[model samples]
Target: MNKRLNSVMARVAAAGWLIAAMLSAETVTARAEAVVAPADGYGFSVGAPMTWMSRAEADGELDAAARTGASWLRVFIDWSRVEPMPGAYNWGYVDHWINGALARGIRVLGLIGYSPDWARAPGVYFTGPPTDPAVFASFVTTVVQRYGDRVANWEIWNEPNLPLFWGYLGDRAAGYTELLKAAYPAVKAVQPGSTVIAGGLSPAFAPDAPPTFVAEMYDRGAKGFFDAMAMHPYVFPHGLEADTLNGWSDVERVRQLMVANGDGDKKIWMTEMGAPTSAPTAEGVSQQEQAKQILDGLRRAAQTPYSGPAFIFSIRDSDTANQDNREDNFGALVTTDWQPKLAASALAR
Candidate 1:
C-alpha cells in the first residue's frame, strides 16, 4: 500500500463515481444463490494496482502468477472504486481482473473495503469507517450479488486494527465489528456458502496487537460474524519464529484468544506476509533471506490445520527505484522491470 497510489486511485475512483451517478439509475438486483468452494492452497497478492493496468501488462502479471502454481489471488474489491455514490457502480475495472484470474484457473479472495467520499465519516481520511454500517453492508450486498459466484472468499477490510488503514476515530475494534456484523449477514443472504473472513489484522503493539484487538472484537460480539480470522504476520527482517513482539509468534496468541472466545474451530488465514529486500535498513533483508522467510511462513501456516491459505503481500515490485520505501519492495516474484527474483523460483518449487 503505497499512499501515492492510493491518492491516485482515490481521485480516479471519485471520477468513476461521478460518471456512474450521471449515467445510471439502476438498483441492485437479487441473484440466485451459489456455493463457493473454499481455497485449497496458498497464493500471491497482485495488489490493487491490477485494476488499473493495461490488458497486456495485467495479463503478463497474471501469467507470472500462474507460473508460480498459485491456486488463489488476493485482489482488492475496493468499495470506493466500485461505487463512489449510493446506487451507482462502475464494475469494469474489477470485472476485468476477477474474470481474468478465473480464466487462468485462479480463485480470488476479494478484499472488499474502503469508503468513498460520500460514505466516509466526516473529517477522516478516505480509509475511515463509513457513516453508516448498513451503507457499507449495502455495498457488500451489491458486491456479492455480482461477483459471489466467482469469488468465494471475502475479506471485510484491510488491517482495520492499524490507524494507517483505519483512521484514528472511535474504538477501532468496535468500529470494525460493526462493519463485520453488518457485512456477514449481507454476504450470507446473497451467497450463503461464501467464506466471510474477518479483516486481516496487522502486526502491531499495545492495545492494537493481534491478541488484544481480537479480544476486543470478541468482546464487541464479533465472534459469529466471520467464518475465519485473517492476519498479516509480516516479521520481515526477523525469521518467522522470531520471539519479538508483533512477530509471527503472536498469531498463536490470537488463536488462543479465539479458542477462549469459543470459536476454536475457525482457521486463521495469513492473507499478507512478505519481507522487503531494500538495503541499508534494519527492516530490509537479502533477496535470499526474503525467499526463505516467506517459504517458512507458508510452510508453518500449511502445517497448522487451524490455519488457512497464506498469500504473499505482492507479485512484483511497485518501485525498485524507491530504495527507502519498504512497501515498494515486498514483491516476492519479480522486480520492477518484471525480472524474476530469487523468491520466484523458490516459491515455484
Candidate 2:
C-alpha cells in the first residue's frame, strides 16, 4: 500500500474509535440519570385536631387536604366523640371522615385521646382517667375493632407531658404509662399488626422531659411497647432551618432511650411540627419561604435512616382556642371561604 493511502486508513480507524468512546460515555451518563432516586423527604400529611372535627361534619376538607401535598391525614379520635354516651356509641362523624379520606387515597393516622366525661371516674377532669385500666383498654379495643382495618397508625394521646392535654394531671409518665399499658395490649389484641404510637410530649425544657418517661418503661421490665417514637418538635417559624431541626435535643432524647431499651432499630415519626405562614414575620419562615422550609425539612428527614413520616400540626385554624393561641395559626394551610393559602398551594402533591 502507498504511504498516503495507508495514513488515510489509519485516520479512519482512529475516528471510529473516538466515536465509539463518545457513545459509551453518553450511554453511561444516560444510565446514571435514569436510576430512580428514593423519596429523601416524604410528602407531609395534614392533621385535623379533634376540635375541628368535633364542631361539624367532615366535608371536602379531606379532599382539600389531599390536594395540599399531603398523603396522610391525622384525625384525633376522642373516646367521647364516638362513644360520647356510655353503651350508645355514635360512629356517624368518624365513619364519614375515614371512608371519605380512604376513598380519596388519603391515609389516616388516628390519634385516640381523653376519656369521655361519662366513662371517666367522677372528679377526674370533672370525670377521671378510667380508674380501671381495663375499662380504658376496653375503650381502646372497641375503637380498634371499629376502625382497625381503615387506620394503621394510632397515637395514644396528645402531648401527654402538657397539663392541658393530660387534663391537668401532675404525673405525666405514670398517667400516660398507665393508660398505655392497658391501651397498647387492647389495641394489639384486636389488631395485631397495628402501629401503637405513644403520644409525644410537647417540646419543652419545663417538666424537664421526665427522665423516666421511656426509661421507666424499660425499667419496669417492659419490652418495646411501641413500634415507632412520636415527637412533637414544634419547629416554630424562626426555627425551621435544617440545622435547627437537626439540632433539636428531641433526637438525642429519644435516640438514647431507644438504644438503652434495646430497641435501637425503632424508627421516629415526627407526629407534629409546624409554623405560621402569615405574610413574612420577623422571626418565622415567611409564607414564601415556608414552602421552601417544608420542602427542605422533608427532604432532610427522608435522608435520615430511621425517620418514618411527619404529620404537620394541623389542617384548619381552631376556633375554640384563644387568640394567644399559637396553635390557632399553626395550620400549615389555612382556609377562608373555601380558598387555600399560597403556602398550601405551593406544597401540593
Candidate 3:
C-alpha cells in the first residue's frame, strides 16, 4: 500500500509539470500569432539606398531596384555631407539620387541628421549629438524647405542608439528627444502632409537605446513628435526563423510597448534589416543563408500587423569588396560586377 501511494504521488507531480509546460508554450504561441496578421496601408515594400552609386550609375541601379519589387528608396541627407560650412549647401548630388528614384516610380525616405564640424563636440566626430538643438533644427528647416516638395517621408537620423551614430556614449535619448521635438514641427511646418519618422534605432546594449530607448522617448513627451517609429531589427548570425525570445524578435516587443502607450494606431517601420554573406564572423552568415534570411525577413515583416515599409541595408555591396569583411557583403543581392546576387534574384520572384 505504501509503494502504490508513492507511485500515485509521482504521477500526479509529473502531470502537473506537463500541464504547466503546455500552458507556457500556449502563451508564447499566442504572442507570436498576434504579430502574424498582414499589415494595412503599405503592406511590405523592399528597397535600399543606393547611396554609393555614382551619379551616372544611379539610374541603372534604381532601375534594378524596381525590378526587384522595391517601391521605396532610402537616402541620407547627411547634414555634414550637404552643408559642410555654416551657410552654404550642396543640392546637386542629393537632387540627382532623389530625382532618379522618383523617375523610376519609387518613393523615397530621406534620412537627415549628423552634425557639421562647427556644431559637433570639440575633438570628437560629427556623428556625435550636436551641441545645440537650435542649430540642428535650422539645418532641418533648410533641407525640408528645399526637398520637401518631393520627399514626403523623412527619417530624422540613422541609428542614435549606437555610439557610432549618436556618439555621446551615455544616456542620450533625452538629447535626441529635444532634437526630434525641434525637427518634427519644423518638418511639418514646411511639408504639412509629410511623415517625419524618428531615426532608426539599432539594437544596442545601451540603456537609452532600442527596446528601452523607445519607451524613454515616449516618457519624455515624444508622442506627438513623429508620425512613425523606426528600428533596425537585424538578426545576423542567427537564422530568420530563430526563436523570438531572443532580442531580434523584440520588434514585436516594441509593438507591445507602443500599444501600451496608446500609440497602437501608429506604424513601426523596420527601416533596416539584413544579414551579411561574407566569411563567418560574430554576425555574418553564409551566402546561401543570406538569400534565405532576406526572403524570410521580408515575409515576417509583411505578416506583422504593425509593420510598415522594410528596407534592406543596401542595393549593392560597397565597391571596396573584401571576402573577410561582412559589412562589405550585406548586399547579397548583387555582386561587385553589378550582377544579381542570389538573394536579389530570389526577392524578384
Which pairs of residues have clashing backbones in candidate 1? none
Q: Candidate 1 vs candidate 2: which has greater TM-score?
A: 1
Global lDDT scores for all candidate models:
0.78, 0.60, 0.69
Off by over 4 Å in 1: 1-39, 243-245
Per-residue lDDT, model 1, residue 286, is 82
What lDDT is reached at residue 324 by model 2? 53
lDDT of 3 by residue, 146-211 (tens): 888889888888788777788655666777888899899998888999988985888766464476
Q: What is candidate 1's lDDT per residue for 1-349, written digit by digit as tens?
A: 5755654553344233323322332311100011111245888876667767665556556666676678888888888878888778989878877887899899899998889989986788888889899999999998998987788789999999988788667589999999999999999999999899996988888878888888889999998899999998788777766735465677888889989989899888889888898874737888778877777777677667788888888877788778788888888766776655666656452
Estimate candidate 1's RMSD in Å: 11.9
Per-model TM-score, in order, reads 0.86, 0.77, 0.82
Instruction: Determine which window of 10 residues in candidate 1 has minimal summed lDDT.
Output: 27-36
- Flag the better candidate by lDDT, 1 or 3: 1
Clashing pairs in 2: 40-302, 69-349, 124-127, 124-128
RMSD of model 3 against the true structure: 17.6
Off by over 4 Å in 3: 1-53, 206-209, 243-248
Candidate 3: give the clashing pairs.
333-341
